[model samples]
Target chain A: MKILIADDSRVMRQIVIRTLRQAGYDDHDIVEAEDGAEALAKVGSESPDLILSDWNMPNMTGIECLEALRAQGSSVPFGFVTSEGSAEMREKAANAGALFLIAKPFTEDTFKEHLDGVIA
Target chain B: MSTTDTGQRRRGSDSRPVITDLMDEDTILAVAGDAWISLVGEDEVLVPIPGEMPGDVLSSWVDVVGPWTGSVVLTTGRATAEALSRALLRESAPEVLDDEDVEDAFGEIANVVGGSIKAALPGPSGLSLPQVGHSPLVRNPADVCRVEVLWRGEPLTISVQGALPPLPVTH
Candidate 1:
């Protein structure tokens, strides 16, 4: 499976990639996008199996990208890897069709717990 | 009332709880401690003690706009910021660090810390992208909740300062 990680901060993108490896999901191919607009563009070109995106980003937000994808009739599995995990954001993400949210300061275990069933 | 015309009915400042009313120093410290363990390292722990800041320092922060608007700022010496960037990058860290690398890494720390702090606040707030530079000035001293901690024996400060000036004192 291929995973596309979108975050404006390069440091955060690298950390997500690192945590994925630490979670033992190292076999999948990885793609990176700097912001939500790039993420939206990549969805067309990359056709990733999974998308892990940050909530607050330049250009487009993760939720906006998700809505756009659904509007375009794309059903790619989406999740958020963001700093905030408030009930409101989670509800917003889920209503927009997010699979799950992994808050920041996450651990390998957190990734594994969220990805096991999702990732083949 | 805040959005109404004439600006006659100002939102009573008393109704909007300040940072101290919502959170205290210990809570901020706990949040920062968790971030340190995750990003900096597992064994790394922040010492809850105040230290005199050095003359030259750098700050990274993210603004929280909502019921209680403020910025979650992290300030430390330039050297310490570089050290943190290296630690965050670990094996991927370049030997020679550039200004951009420090800003990106250090700013991310603020992002995470700020995000967590936002969640702890009252609600439905918007967080701005992380910024790296001199800290935003404290607009309302009473609205600020500051915590000083030592990371790796270096002084660091996490300040949750209000973005707006104190509401007009109703006589």
Candidate 2:
């Protein structure tokens, strides 16, 4: 299995990767993109099984990337790992066809709860 | 009649709501405390007891623009920021840290804390990408909610300060 993580901040990407491991989802290949633009490009090249992305980023945003992906007819599973998890953002994410949104300050348990049925 | 339109109005004061009106010091501490444990370490704890900040300080913040326009800022000593960066990096931390590393890690901490603060406020708010440098100037004294904490015996402060200056008193 493979997962692509998109976030502008390298530190945040690393933390997301670490949290994935801590959540016991350790047996997957991971690809990284620095921003939403790169993430859009990588979706073509990498064809990842799932996407874990941050909402805000330089170039394009996570929502834009997700929109682009859907417009392109790519149905790869998608989720948000972001700082903002307000009802507004969550509704936006859901409306955009995201599987889930795991807000920041999350624990391993949070990841497990959200990624369970999606990962398999 | 001249009236500036803020996204929200204070029912009692007939003016725009300030940071203090929306949240308080305890909220700031609680928000920062959660970010610390999640990003820094599970065992890491932020002591709420105020401590004098050192001479060399750095700040990272995210601007919140909405019903309450302001910046959620985290400031600490340069060395302390680097220590936090290392902690965030964990096994990937390089032996020698660079400015970008500190900026990415420290700025992200501000981003998370700021994001939570924004959610707690009356939103439909937009959050800016994190920035790192000296702290932004406080435009309104009474519009700020600040919390001082000691993290690993080093002083750190989280301030949610309004972007606008105080409104002129009207009769």
Model 2 per-residue lDDT tens digits across residues A45-90: 9989999999999899999999999999999999999999999999
RMSD of each: 3.9, 3.4
* Per-model TM-score versus the true fold: 0.94, 0.95
| DockQ of model 2, rounded to 2 decimals | 0.91
lDDT of 1 at A36: 88
**Where does model 1 sit among the CAPRI classes?**
high
True-structure RMSD for candidate 2 = 3.4
Instruction: Tell me the tens digit of each residue's lDDT in model 1 across A18-104.
Output: 999999999999999988899999999999999999998889998899999999999999999999899999999999999999999
* lDDT for model 2: 0.94
Model 2, B1-171: lDDT tens per residue? 778868476564476898988998888888888999999999999999889888999999999999899999999999999999999999999999999999999999999999999989998999999999999999999988898899999999999999999999875
**Over the true interface residues, superposed, what is the Cα RMSD of model 2?**
0.5
Report the C-alpha displacement of residue A103, candidate 2, in angstroms. Answer: 0.3
Q: What ranges in model 2 sit over 4 Å off?
A: B1-14
